[model samples]
Target chain A: MFKRSVFVAAYLALSAGAAHAEFSGGVIKIGVLTDLSGTYSDISGQGSVIATQMAVEDFGAAKKGMKVEIISADHQNKGDVASSIARQWYDRDGVDAIVDLVTSSTALAVNQVAKEKNKVALVSGAASSDLTGKDCTPNTIHWAYDTWMLANGTGSAIVKTGGKTWYFITADYAFGHALERDTTAAVEKAGGKVLGSVRHPFPSSDFSSFLLQAQASKAQIIGLANAGADTTNAIKQGAEFGITRGGQNFAGLLVFITDVHALGLNTAQGLIVTTSFYWDLNDQTRAWSKRFFEKHKRMPTMVQAGVYSSVLHYLKAVEKLKADQDGAKVIAQMKAMPTDDPLFGKGRVRQDGRKIHPAYLVEVKKPAESKAPWDYYKIRTTIPADQAFRPEKEGGCPLVK
Target chain B: MNAIFGIPTQALFGQLLIGLINGSFYALLSLGLAVIFGLLNIINFAHGALYMMGAFGAYFLLTKFGIGYWWALLISPLAVGLIGVAIERLMLARLYKLDPLYGLLLTFGLALIIQGLFHNEYGSSGMSYPVPQALQGAKDVGFMFLPIYRGWVIAVSLVVCFGVWFLIEKTKLGSYLRAATENPGLVQAFGVNVPRMITLTYGFGVALAALAGVMAAPIYQVNPLMGADLIIVVFAVVVIGGMGSIMGSIVTGFGLGVIEGLTKVFYPQASNTAIFIIMVIVLMFRPAGLFGQR
Candidate 1:
């Protein structure tokens, strides 16, 4: 009787082990790499982590018998630092995929590491169009908006509206140069003249000298090709100098909702910019953003929203495979599937790893127009997915052919 | 349209004026650094953090107590000075006998803690402090339009710089302070209360930075990291001016600011590097700094 019982127990254990193997090979870990203490922290730091957690919980990865774990680290917006972290995460920590890289330089660095290590990266925070253009990789997906899309959306819109003569106060860096180049193309294409440009040091507090140069150009619009505190300071000091009242407009090429909030309506009003997502855009966005706000105490910027959408879609691809999938294969599966999330709505990933979604042009409302807290942006029009970004053939991506 | 060296006159003058305004800040900040380093024999790396606190103090005074900018001009520095006294008495006083690098490192750590606290509470984005009604609008000089508040900043900082210069260089108290800087033990033998003088001198030096901060609150975005970067540039200014001489810091501060402004017009690429480049040149010519005494 004892011999029969022992054989029965061994048989049951073997069957259970086979069942687990069929469901998933082992635990899958995703790393959230972003700027935590530096300039981009407000938009992508802790908020992106929270958004990813929400997606993990909602996706029910564990119920499918695949244990998924999340980890995060601060990239500090440096390329070397980001590369080191990516290398360790991929080589040692078994971080299968990384998400939410903020600065473009860092994102580009991590993208190379991901490709070299055979891990996937979902870039939600970085805005350089080069990620999909010349630096395109099968291991990375450029989620959220990019510089080309922003320039095409806001630059052309402003130029078409007769604010034609332009001067650029560009931050002296890769992201700023790309933005200025793309926006200049957009303006010229719309029959606008490029007056001039001044490249200021990054994170400069005094925009007086730069603004003075912009003023001297006497352009109808001063294009700010910078982000974070640099843009906010330019707008604030522009108001102090009465740049707008003197008959010139300020076109913020890359403005976030948090930036608008920081500048407040009095300074930021009448400024027009482009974005991929806004919290109060529709019922679905509002519902998702409201749930996010309940936990984060602020509305979700598009980057934070993108984290949710991409992570959910990534998990879906993993589940469909029913085992730990390779990075390139997982990305291919994700590209094959359509992305539908409450925050961003339904979108598609292209061959060059650009996500297709309708981008919105928004105007900052006057103080009197804001009805409630975080009621900042008033949507003017939507650039349909096909028209939002540059055409595939023009981007020069190797994968496009 | 009149142009100078192929650059428009308005742009040139406008940038020069801006350079002068920036020079005013550099002058005040470096002057304080020179004064503290002379007597204390330690670099107060927390000077920038203290400047940031001064701006926050003024901001709180306005938002919390309905105190206006004019009153803040008086109260903010006093408050920041008191905090500096406490810091000197409790923390900095212990490091007086150690290597000066320890003092610098300790203060640097303190700077990070202070900046982190502000970043946690208020965030990295700037909070605008409104210009006082009495000092709004601009007076157009034919070359360029200069805002009245900017002009006020230039005039007031210059006056304060000169006033501090007079206090340190021309007064009886100044002589004693100078004597103590030479030999505190000898000054103590003369019944000069050397320790008390060190504490007050530190407080007064810190007050100069706070005054600049309160003055700056109206113009620049009052943010946490504002002082962090500016302090680095000011240190470069001190090195160029030679931290030994009061007037060297004052002159170098203003001179560098104007040079930076000029660079912005003729060559926009070198504006940020102009000051540092000049510092490198000056150090090669005069290892003790232009005004620094050996």
Candidate 2:
């Protein structure tokens, strides 16, 4: 009996030791809160998770004596669901930072929870300017695109080119409203007039009526202030209804290359839009995009690229501080230094926690212009970082003062 | 004379035309839902997914298989219907004896699984399905330059909606369906294969949704989550129309769509909430629905 008990005890100790080795010795846990299985699932879902994994792997999967662990959960595109998950991750799961929140509403909700928990939030997907504006949090960083960049990239550029008379098909939501308001300001500043506008429900499937009104208005420019599937539907229906052939230009205020690829160059040709990143921008972008496509099976979108850069920068911050699990120290170190990543080019974090990066104005490639799959955009111009975002004093970030 | 709100007549009429176009989709989708619900007693939570799948079917047929929109219009729905048949026979038939809620739950689960698989393959960005070469440009009507595809959608949806109504209301097969709904055991005792009919009926209803989806592909991007957001609004439309009458579902769907369009012109802020507001009013006044017998 004694011999049998000794053998069992020895086996139990060996198993426990292996388990300890797996997670022990200073672990840094990152919670990737994303819309993995909901309305915005296709936009930033599993791709964001993949980007986080790539960042961890690039960092040698460990730094100093610490092993980097990435834990992911689907926010399901609901604010309350995101908040609950974030609360759980902070209070019980030993998570030091959260990244890749996709929707503006969910991002804001998570930002508040991250603030309360004193954890770092590297927001890569949500594009609301308010993340760095009225709703800004000290613990949160708006890492990718925002309303200001989109407004300056598409709205101002078109207005300056003499497509001055404007109408808008605005999505009726906070994010939509912000895009419209910011883009409208940019247009009016460029000596354009707002002739009229229409607000469609978010995720509206039919846009024939809106297009007809746009056609009738005879506006020189028709701006689409929507994103995701709504923008896709509006642009497609706009082509079907022949709004462009009637001498009106269609401007996508918050478009991505994927939307252009979906609309195809035939319908999307000559449609100008602004974005922070495009896969085919240059040799550098193409190199990073090639690896991402190999892993994800699709070209990396601006959101995906942002996810890669945010994760890389956060991991770098962890290494600099040498404290694997210190959220505040790591965040302070991140803001104290400039960010250098292949995806973002060269960027810096401002006082308001806004990541300052050059925004690009890209036109949809003509079908004949695209030589291969995923080659959907041609860069029109580059908006300098200083002009891409609102000035610091005007940003309305309470932490700025 | 100027309008009460001082809105111009031409603009009002233009906006009204827009409303009518939106109403067309509402009517078509709701009619399909009502037909399926009457016999199956199950709210197809996957109806939107099926619709989205149909759009993708048309897109794939055109882009990869070199098929055109017209062929897609016919084959895509049939293809999706076959998928529906398989699902019904393999999975849904087993849940019939349980609470009707099980069918809803099962279909919802199926929707999630299908949508998840598509998202995994095609990320969230919308992909465009091009208009066929023949239907490339617009018809200049002076008042509006109507794209040929839009005209086709409005016209085809009308024909399909009425054709469906005629099938259920005037045909012997529809009589059997109605009878089965009233009492399946009695219909079975009369030497009718009611269970098979039930399965086919569900498949047919699902096929209608898929047809709408295929028709929509050229007009909208074919995205994985396309059906999810549209489905809730459709459910609200169905609820307001009352699942009792097919024609009611069709009319309410179209009427609410037009109202929503008009709201976009007059009160831009309330445009998104207009349909839901109407639903609330309908619930308050006629809880059974505008056309419901109750």
Candidate 3:
């Protein structure tokens, strides 16, 4: 009787292994919805799309007897547009998962749509911590860095290291509000004081008035609670307006490699920033980024890198589950299994859907210090994975239990 | 530290200066739009694209040919103006007899195509152009620490705005150009070469937009979408000041900029909306505009 039972169990296991990955219509479709031509485009647009493809190709989907199809759309950094595109992708196009919603508005919008449709949305581009906080959902995975991580990384570092009094030129949006709040908390915790902050319009090209406000506040540090074009423009205009000369330094709360490249080393030099990934961090990163650069001609930003990592992790979970039918189930599996990828190395998706990874605090290299084009950061310190993200209990996420 | 509406006086003063500096751009851009609409009876939606091209022209000249900012200030506008001439000759001239909406659609489509092409090449993060070496520093002017370049921009825009105003309102050729718009057939019968004159006027108006763009290159990062973001605001400025009134555009452009600046100081979040609110108020009150005649 024991021998018969053992043979039966082995046969059941073999059949189950053969039946892994019941892709919809014989394939898993991943939609990369991002800002293709707007303020946040360069960092997360075509580069992100290419990264998603590379992840699929590197995962060897064809060899695994699984077909993966990738499609992309420009959310244009608008919430309504993102929601509509996400609804169509999930309801009509059979996209099992969506990735790389760049702006916070788009990410939050798509997050809700994915939940309603019972599909997966992996966020690598958005920076708002609300995704893992009050808004955390079972059907979504918040990959890479969020506002809390950025504040905990760059904010604490700057405050503890002599940037005591801060005035913020905040973008007038969800991401900006969240960042300002988190950074304020981080600053106060680090024994620093926030003098004041002014909200500016989103994606504004002129920062003269806002910078003047910060200058007049007489703060030791001018914290930029914005990102992409808004941040870059502020930093450039700050120099011209003598905010730097007046001895008020700018702390770029979410500076990307593309933003740094656009600002050039001359202007961006010495600006402190926090990021989840840097291409030249190690041999593994260098090798992967080299392959990426060979394809995209620019180094991958953290958002782009996060997109690749999340897609790979999502794919693995889908394979393990033997189907992509249930979004929550797939996400739970993704959480149950530890994530290992070439971009972020070893990490895990927490119950609140936050991806845990080490963060880096780097200073923009002086023009003289840079050796080549795109050689931007001089990595100052590494924030270990455990200390990088918000604590689960403190995040107000109902899913934490 | 004395306050105005809870904002520090020093800050208020600084904001006022910043507003005027920004107003310089508004005046220049709206002035060009006013001139174009006045002469051509067409809403040239491509003004912003032409502005973008002007910045790119300066960027390319500097990056590729080692040309400095001074030469680019002149060359970019002229070069872009020539492109404007081609546009007028080939496309805009054909739309002269149609509804103004047709001209608007054509130019609007042109703007999209132009912006899309540049965006495909540059990807919209934007490229930085350094302020000229001579104007690289800032001067502490008590109320504000004004960047020398900003001061130069304000001064030059004032001179340019009034210079164009004088040429169009005072000179013989200016009257002929104005007359062509009033009575094109009569102007042509008088051997004024009205067609060529209209084309050159459009070119000149485009060049004025380009000039504003070249000046803006250093203050704002040169991006494909830079002009798109600001063009709508300039249009509002033109509307509020009374479209097609050169002096009206110049005054309201500067005035709205100052009001918007104050909004930045007292209520920083509504700075972008301040102008629109005023536009609504003016529209409800005056219908034609603050200065536009019905």
Q: Best candidate, lDDT-wise?
A: 3
lDDT tens digits, residues A1-401, model 2? 00000000000122222223323234667777887665465557777777777776665643333467677887766678888888988888777788988877788898899888788888988888998999888788898899888987888899888999999898877777888889888899888988888888666767777777777778999899888777778877776776766788889888766676666777778888888888877788888788877877877778878888888888788766666444566677888989998777888988788898998898888889889987777888988998899898897889888
Tens-digit per-residue lDDT, B198-229, candidate 3: 99999999999999999999999999999999
Which model is ahead, 1 or 3, in terms of TM-score?
Answer: 3
Docking quality of model 3: it rates as medium
Candidate 1 docks with a DockQ of 0.50
Which tens-of-lDDT digit does each residue in A1-401 have in candidate 3?
00000000000112324556566766788888988778888889888988998888788777777777888887778898889888988998888999999999999999999999899999999999999999999999999889999999889999888999999999999899999999999999999999999999897888999888788789999999999999999999999988877888999999999999999999999988899999999999999999999988889999999999999999899888879978999999999999998879899999999999899999999999899888999989999999999999899988988
What C-alpha lDDT does candidate 2 achieve relative to the native structure?
Answer: 0.79
Give lDDT tens digits, candidate 2, residues B1-294: 456476666667766766766677777777778888877888789999999999889888887998988899899999999999999899988987899899899999999889978877777776777777787788876556667766777788788888988999899988999999999989999999998998888889888989988877766678888788678778888899897478888888778877887887777667768889899999999998888876
What fraction of the true interface does each of the listed models get right, in terms of native contacts kept? 0.48, 0.73, 0.93
Model 2 has a DockQ score of 0.58
Q: Rank all candidate structures by their lDDT, best first, as comma-separated numbers.
A: 3, 1, 2
Quote the chain B TM-score of every prediction: 0.97, 0.95, 0.98
Question: How high is each candidate's TM-score?
Answer: 0.94, 0.90, 0.96
What do the candidate models score in CA lDDT, each in turn?
0.86, 0.79, 0.90
- In model 3, how large is the Cα lDDT of residue A202? 90
Clashing pairs in 2: A42-B123, A42-B124, A43-B124, A262-B127, A262-B128
Q: Comparing candidate 1 with candidate 2, which one achieves the higher lDDT?
A: 1
Error of 3 at B18 (Å): 0.8
Docking class of 2: medium
**Regions of candidate 2 where Cα sits further than 4 Å from its true position:** A1-25, A324-326, B140-142
